[model samples]
Target chain A: MDRYAPPGAGSAAGAERPQAEVRVPEIPGLPAGIPDGGDAPARHEGGEGDAAAPEAELTPPSAGDRPAQGKSPFQALTVIGQIEGHVSLPSQNKTTRYEHVLPQLIAIEQDPEVQGLIVLLNTVGGDVEAGLAIAEMIRSMSKPTVSVVLGGGHSIGVPIAVAVDRSFIVSTATMTIHPIRLSGMVIGIPQTYEYLDKMQDRVVHFVVANSRISQERYRELMFRTGELARDVGTILVGRDAVREGLIHEVGGMAQALASLRAMVRQGGRHQR
Target chain B: MLYSIIPPEVVLRPADGPAAVLWEEVEASGARRLILRRDADGRVVIERIISTEPRDYLDPALQPGQPYHPGRRE
Candidate 1:
């Protein structure tokens, strides 16, 4: 080891992976090399707790693919489709399950070779709990993380997009921020309304805390009635997203990757 | 230090005229396309960003059941 080597360099080997494993992982169409078997060790927290079922029982063979397994110093996570939580969505509907994401995050957190994370989101937004849980996991990661919004990151996707250390969006990508919605049976109860308000509070607080937007201002956008036809909330375009302070910049993938690399370089100095 | 962008490399145009071009290593996030086209004044100026799409990954031996697809190039 060099006399001035970084702090974690020596210890990184403990978590080393095959060199062919590039760390840019975010729910690939199919994840290879995962030890999917009846004897697969007990899945840690966020495993969705259904390891006993046969592989066919899982939603799509790709849902739990381990694309994140690589020896590189960076990892990419894609928060696409609707985020599925306690209940799995239909197989046909695109989804980012919390179960799959949770373990990957843990690996990224523990892996020494992995230094940073990139979150790519193109979700219409799915279950609130699942989305929020993913966002919280990402925001709490010790390694620096950045998010890029391609296409539309609507509804709860708003929280995930803003959760990163830095954010980027293409000139044409847009994000929609509407009040939360519920699809199932509705009892006209006071507690139900209160629960809704609290849920809204969680999303609003997270977005405001991570980004430059103000609390009242965010709510104002959330409740705005005219921007979206037949829906409330404001629609922010590429530059508009930057102006509103939800995302850090109005740039594309290169900018986001550059930012992540820069953060990792800084981390190299500090040796975090 | 790692964040430093890859420098652009100069490539001469394949025409009989006295023209040259500069190209950047573009990424899928779309921030690429900083082509340095020389203007009439013999000075280079930013022309336009050509494309900003994610590149595809293909493998001939990849089987259908395997997790084989052209993923993000960057």
Candidate 2:
């Protein structure tokens, strides 16, 4: 049993092997492909039979621990703390997603080595509460932050774009600015209607506060006639969004990294 | 339910796009609050209303309407 004991606190394998296999626990809502808990593989003295042991079986495999399998030149930023996700509410994939990001963002804010944060947006926007919570955390962080809009950053992703110190979007990136939407059972009444208005106000206030744009301008875009196939919002291109004050710039990886570097530099000066 | 007792309507919009509505009117306890979102194709959503007042208002995230805030209890 001692031989199979994990190498470190979280890992099941020891840290002796130059190249090892790692396993991560299953995240509750994420797909099977996304890693769950963090586990690593270690070299064992025994042969075939040891592989069948329960400890080895229980620990899943991790991509990080895999030996150099003739992969392309690697480029990755070490995860300083954690990447939080909240699957409490379902999104497009019918699972509550993005709720966990807030907690992760908070943890990152407190980490000293984090230097900066980068948000990769590809969500269609799930629970507004969860999305806004994560966005607020990102906006409040003293560390420099940057967001890259890829695929789609509709609805909730709008806040995500503004939360960072700087943001970037690929030429093909698309973002939708629409009215706040609600889900669950709804009973129509005057009081209910009133509640809806106030809620919209809150969203507008937050977006205006964090971004370079104004509330009036945002409303105009949200209420656009027909940008979406069947929706009542405008889908702005990278350059168009930047021109409208919704996004800061329109470029790919190079531009994003440059903005991040600038933000990081600014943060360093603030600390001094 | 009674509201903030404001003498006038404080109509404010955040951006120039279609306004996203929030359901539920709770107390504005802190600067940190959650924003809700719906997956593409208008499916699955959740909104938590938090305000620094008695009895929060639970409104739908979509469907255009008026703002719900803390006010006098009826």
For all the predictions, what are the DockQ values? 0.02, 0.01
Error of 2 at A123 (Å): 1.1
Going through the candidates in order, the fraction of native interface contacts each one reproduces equals 0.00, 0.00
Model 2 Cα shift for residue B17 (angstroms) = 39
CAPRI-style docking class of model 1 based on DockQ: incorrect
DockQ of candidate 1 against the true complex = 0.02
Backbone clash tally (model 2): 80
Deviation (Å) of B50 in candidate 1: 31
Clashes of each: 4, 80
Residues A82-194 of candidate 2: C-alpha lDDT, one tens digit per residue: 11232111110212233234444554566454566677776555445655666787777777777778866766667767777777788788777776544333657788767
TM-score of 2: 0.53
lDDT of each: 0.56, 0.45
lDDT of 1 at A155: 78
Give the per-residue lDDT of model 1 (tens digit) for A1-272.
00111112222221232333222222212233222311221111111121232222122333333333335566677777666555433223345666557767877788777788888888777667778888999888888888899987877888899888888888788898777654334759989878878888888999999899999989888889989776678899989988998888887779888888898878731111
